[model samples]
Target: MAGNSDPLTPRAKIAVTAGKAVAAASRAAGRGSGSVIGGRVALKLDPDLLARLAQNLDVVLVSATNGKTTTTRLIAEALRAAGPVVSNALGANMPAGITSALAGGSEARYGVIEVDEKYLAGVARDTDPKCIALLNLSRDQLDRAAETRMLAENWREGLAGSKAVVVANADDPLVVWAASSSPNVVWVAAGQMWKDDAWSCPSCGGVMQRPGDDWFCGECGFRRPQPSWALSGDHVLDPHGSAWPIRLQLPGRANKANAASSAAVAAVFGVPPQVALERMYQVQAVAGRYDVVQFMDRDLRLLLAKNPAGWLETFSLIDPAPAPVILSVNARGADGTDTSWLWDVDYTRLTGHPIFVVGDRKLDLAVRLEVANQHFQVCENVDQAVQLCPPGRIEVIANYTAFQDLRRRVGN
Candidate 1:
């Protein structure tokens, strides 16, 4: 619980108490996550509560289409060396969640927050953060979100007047376009594995050319920006030609990229690169991501993939050999009502592997996999799906709602 302090006014103090009470009641009831509802009540009582609490704090805001939660966790871990750090680790990324975090961690001197992509502009403006990290951009939650380019434009417009230093991914063209307007910017070549969304140049509407990992526009002069921090394989190269090894317990190149991005943001706050990287490696799991859970008869490693880009990166991280895998999906409010993005994933890559499709949308995934001629079986439940596997270790990957369900069931 956050302590009530002198920084909060009389009205703000009342709102905080009310919000915390609601959170406690909701948690006691077990209806749903209390973070969102508690924050809503707080904001309703005091609309300017977030801005007031954020004053005089060293804040870092992280936004992206994917990996924002993990990246924010890494940044928060690195900032722990300085002092107490307050962050929203529950995956509540909107204004309500951001406000709740600020209100709860009133005594902390530093804040590391994960802001949703659509709300990045408004939150950054209100918080007046010291640094902002832009990971990448892709099509996600098409039912609710605007087009990728539109979001990028909004980000460009939102950060135009911000004095905060922007740490952006140079490999992602959309991220480059969004953060280009900021006067204080640091570019990092954090490796963009998914390029389907960035086929066209946002500036000129021209076809972008990708010639062996480098992107350039034929019509416009837009090209991949030179990076101040570059991640080559397992090593992060600094501008002065020095390389630092990033050894993280989390697997995959995507996590390596995340570590590099965190190191860049930490540098802006006077955290040494070695210290930042060391702290980043301490994170073994985040919000059930990359966690191995012991079920009735199997050990399942959880992975969350919400979009085509996320699936691509997650697929690459899996072992090449065929094994038992459980893919759970749901189209609930949090998972997006439209499951059309399933078609965009290259299911053919798992041709020889044994796959178990489980979730409300298992039929949809089965149809897509059938069209791809991939072998798979649909199970009634997660436990049932895992029961089909031979034994030992099984990999479980899920979207938003299904991941949460599994996380709660497994007690992660």
Candidate 2:
């Protein structure tokens, strides 16, 4: 908890108390972190708990297919240059989990929220955030989370009705279309590696004209906005063309882009660019992503990639050729039940790596790899997988639940 400037109503206080108690109990029982269950109980007791907790706090909502969690964490740290900040969600991101996070940090000056794409509209309506960062929209968890277009439409309608300043990616058509309806949008030239989902224009259903990283719609004439802020190599360029270097402890170009977007959002909060970037550089990992842990006498660097878009980025993060890379997956509800997304990834890009497959759905992944002619061994878990690989550092990339399973086992 941060402060006591705004007091909760009696009913809301009771809800918060009960929710924290339940969360603590759940943690003790090892059922999970209790973020979801505790917030669920709190909401059951007081339906207005979320709204009540959000009051008096400047909130920043971050939604994207791949980097929402990392972006949210980065935004929180960047805002800390202004004051005490509490992030809304990490692993838990729905209404319930968000409520729990708000309750836990009742008096923080800011709430940097990692919102699930499907729930962004409702969550945004509830929080009435000061700013919203609309990262790229792609086909993720399609079986349950709806298609990317539907989520875009939802965001379009929601942003059209809100007063929040939108910081959006200019490279993603779906995201651009969604944020276009907003009154105040700060477009940023954040790179988007996965272009599979943005082939058609959302405005007129015209075939999108994408030449290299540039894009346009021939029918409706909608195109990427002239970004006021853009990224040049490892530096972030402001509206005035002043470039600020971004130094992050996190790995990959994807993370550097995340830092750029976070700094843009923090600028709306009155934090200076250098201050924001410096604070963001302090963040080593988000949740368990990009975490390196010692396991079974081998260093396991954990990475998470659930969809084709995320996989494209993950492929670039691993060590160069012949490094042992373990790919794990699961069909649990947390991960969309269908394993069909496995076929969407260009597994041939990993041709030279010594790959291994694990998790409940390893066989499905093995079959996918077989078609691509990528050689890999099947192991029961990280322990067995690491035992077979040469001693030193090994990379592990897993889907949602499989990542969580290994993260929990490794004591993250």
Candidate 3:
């Protein structure tokens, strides 16, 4: 219910009131997420609703093909040291979702937003964020986001002439190219675990060569930008070569990279590096990415993997032992219909581990696993699948819709 107290035009005030009522009704009826529908209605009534809401707020936008939600949460949490901050904690990254969050937290002085990759340009132009964090880019929803290169090109053009300082991943060549036009940039060596998408230089279309931590293109003379911030093992290295140990509740190197990226963004706002790292350590889960839920007779740790890069990172977080893992995938609207990206994932990483396949596309996953010589069992239902595993903690990795469904069922 917190929002801007400033006087609004009669029409704009009416639109806000109507949107609030719709959001409340949607929450009451449980028909949908309510985040988008209300915003959709408000935008229809006032096309400039988002821009108005963003007028006086200091905004920090986080966008990437993957990890946008988690990274956004990290940055928002760190910004709490300054004062009250507004953010979309429900995994809403599109314009509608952003509109709802800005409207709800209108009075807050600072905003941390997770923006969809394809809509980054428009959102950046609308909000005029103080700092825009470019994490990494890769093929996400081929059905929706046709090409990563196109997204980078759009970002390059979108950020042009903006006064916002850019915080970009130096290890990601695509990110480097995308934020190249920004006048002010802070580069961080947040590790790029997935390189398949950036094998070719986006600038000159030449094959890129990686020697150690640096990458360069023979054809374009484009190379990895030197990072001002970087993560070394369990510590963060600053431009001055000082190291600070980072403690995080989230597992995996990717999450550490996310923390580094957030720390860099926080520094832009004058937040101490130690304070930012400490704040990030307190974040246990984002939406349901790494939440552990008890279902039936077992504890299920939920991990969301929508594409090959995501799967790769999630797989590394799993214990090397032969523990039972459940994988669910759906071709619903939220999850891209084309599941061919499954072929790109290295399923062999779980070669000896036990896997339980579930969801509408369980058969597809089963075939992929079989091709990799990995043993797996098909369970159409997640609740039923948990019963097959030993009575302990189990790992559940699912795509977009399937993950959300499991979170709903488990009351997470």
After superposing candidate 3 on the true structure, give the runs of residues whose Cα lies further than 4 Å from its correct spot. Answer: 1-7
The 0-to-1 C-alpha lDDT of every candidate, in the order given, reads 0.89, 0.89, 0.88
lDDT of 2 at 398: 93
Measured against the true structure, the TM-scores of the candidates, in listed sequence, are 0.97, 0.97, 0.97
Q: Kindly report which residue stretches of model 2 are placed more than 4 angstroms away from their true locations once superposed.
A: 1-7
In the range 292-403, model 3's lDDT, one tens digit per residue, is 8888878889999999889999999986768788999988888888888999999989877788999889999899998999888998698778888889889899999999
* lDDT at position 188, candidate 3: 92
**Judged by lDDT against the true structure, how good is candidate 3?**
0.88
- Which residue pairs collide in model 3, if any? none
Report the alpha-carbon TM-score of model 1 versus the true structure.
0.97
Writing each residue's lDDT as its tens digit, candidate 1 over 1-412 gives 1233465788988888888889879989986668888888998998888887888588899999989999999999999988899999877999988888778886688889999999999898788899999999999888988999999999999999689999999999999999999999999999988989999998889999999878989998999988999998898887787899999999999999999999999888888888999999899999889988888777889999999999999998776657778898899987788999998999887877899998889999999999999889999998788778887788888999999888887777
lDDT at 104 for candidate 2?
86
Residue 136's lDDT within candidate 2 is 91
